[model samples]
Target: MSMTSILLTILGIAIFVVGLLFSIAWHELGHLSTAKLFGIRVPQYMVGFGPTIWSRKKGDTEYGIKAIPAGGYIRMIGMFPPGADGRVEARSTSPWRSMIEDARSAAFEELEEGDEKRLFYTRKPWKRVIVMFAGPFMNLILAVAIFLGVAMTFGFQTQTTDVAGVQKCVISQSEKRETCKESDPVSPAQAAGLKVGDKIVAFNGQKIDEWSVLSDRIRDTIGPATITVQRDGQEKTLHAVLKKNAVLKKDSDGEVIPGKYVSAGYLGFAAQTEIVPLSFGDSVVRMGDMIENGVDSIIALPSKIPALWDAAFSDGERAADSPVGVVGAARIGGEVMNLDVPAQNQVAMMLFVLATFNLSLFLFNMLPLLPLDGGHIAGALWEALRRNVARIFKRPDPGPFDVAKLMPVAYVVAGVFICFTLLVLVADVVNPVKIS
Candidate 1:
């Protein structure tokens, strides 16, 4: 890569890291604000992990930035209550028992005389659930707002029926030749006097509104047909006999697969694309589609691990749809900055990448696994359910579901996540995804 390209890539990565820090801080802010609003004592609100890089005390909370910029947290006092005998400190012979007690003791390490009423566990179960749920919900709200704003303002690239260019001759897509050869036959579109900028109005007497529908219709039909076009403020009809030719089939990313070819009706014209703003409902519908795709990507992540390993170690071609880590995403952002498109287009694409990242954060954190916000929410809900059932049956109250007991399981989950992250990191460095 050129020096300029390298510089642009570094700049893009820096901007993305900044965006990530802000996102982590924003998520923690949600928890801090809600906890304070509910009269809970939040001692510290720190973004990132490890040693404190910057901090300042404001009111009752000490806000700080940490050295490691991976993730963030807000410390809520009394996250778990003491044992049944009201004992905060206890000794155990078993290692697992010690782990549970250690976690419970840490929860009340800073307990003060007046802090009992302000404890997080003292709040109603529903309120505790909301407090825990607020963090990921904030991310979800931000993702939606960013998506809607970008769609309404910068808009999205949409293909239209207007002709952008006409091929000079009918060349098989598999051949991939730009210039016409000596024996190359004239394209049907050229022979029919079709010009660039002509808007396709109808195909074979059928009114066509969407470019996708028109393209599919043309590809399906190989015989002679009347095509109506709006040219120079006048509607005109042209008759042409489309030829059945070998064309390379493309995947979702619009890249031609090597062995994928289909005999489709060829009209040899490229459809024009324009940035068109969407209505609020349309934008929302598009957002739903993105959410669905994100969920599918997460579900299929494990299946991609083998492929990722191969791409990183063996001589394997990284699939275009391979899962990308932070490093890969940063590289893509750099490529986007250096792309030969309008500046506004670049800004829109960057916004899109950030929005998608936030959406993924929201989804990933909501998984009901320990060490995640969703896991805490699940614990609170289960506690509520257990308490209500006991009350109905006139049984003794089980003070709280000891989430601290699950620390061992949480450690296992954290280990798995760390391993997966490292795998992705290696794959990204070795066989990073490239945009063309």
Candidate 2:
């Protein structure tokens, strides 16, 4: 790479790293503030992991930054309840039992004389739930804010009714060839005198405003048709004979499905697209679509494991929608900065990437598994349910749910995550996915 290119790449990566750090700090702030609100003593609020680069002791909490910027945490007192004997019990010979005892011991390792009443597990179940849920909730807020900012100002690319291109001759989609044959029939669009830059206004005397609506109308017609277009500030009517031909299949949302063919009324022109600002309601609808797509990506993640493994360890191609890690995302941010577009567009694209990352963080951390925020929330809710049940039956309280006993499961989950991260790192270095 050239020196200038390298500098741009570094600048992009640096910007992304800054955004990542701020996101991490923001998420931890939610936990720290809520924990303090509920009178739970927090000892540390670190934005990253490994050796601390800087730190300051303020009141009961020590806030700091660490060397690694991948993830972060806030250390709350009494994360797990005491053993059945009403204490942090001794270590046992069994590995799982040892894991539980070690975790319980660490929860009280920084215990002071006045910390007994401020333990996290000693709070009401609802309060504990809020403390754990706040972190991921902060991420969701950040994602929504960033999305709205970009959608309302910088705008999103959308298809319009204007014509961008006109095919000279019709070609069957099943043929998968772009060359025009001498014996082939002229395209309906070209024969009807359609030209690039003409704005399609109506089809067969029916008014049309959106490209999808016009596309659907064109596909459903197969005989004589009248098209109304605005050309050079003048409205003109053009006639053509629609033909039934094999074309690419489109999904319900009007997006073309690649490599799939279906027989439909063929219109041989491509619609123009431009960045258009969206109103609040339209933006909200788009946001909902974005969130639904994110959830779908998460649900389909496990099925992509075999593909990821093959791409990382074998001579297999990496799919475009494969899961991306921090390093991969940073590289994409770099590419976005170097695009041949306006500076505002580049910045908007970068912010969108960061927003997507925050969304993923929110969704991933909310999985109901050990070592994730959702796991603790689930545990707290379960505790509340059982306690309420006991109260209803006039029985004794069940006490706090012993979450530390699941230390072995947490370890397994962490192990799997680490391995997956390593694999993604390897693939990123050797077979990186390029956005452009």
Best by TM-score: 2
lDDT of 1: 0.88
Question: Which run of 10 residues does model 2 get worst, by summed lDDT?
Answer: 250-259
TM-score of each candidate structure, all chains considered together: 0.88, 0.96
lDDT digits (tens) for residues 1-436 of candidate 2: 8888888889999999999999999999999999999999999999999999999999989999999999999999899999998877675899899999999998987898899999999999999999999999999999999999999988999999999999888899899888899988999999999999999999999999998899889989998899999999999999988888998899765778878988889879889999998898988888988898899999998898888888888998988888899999999888887888899988999999999999999999999888999889988999999999999999999999998988899999989989989988988877777886
lDDT of 1 by residue, 187-231 (tens): 989988899999999999999988878877888989898899999
List per-candidate RMSD values in Å.
3.3, 1.6
Off by over 4 Å in 2: 174-176
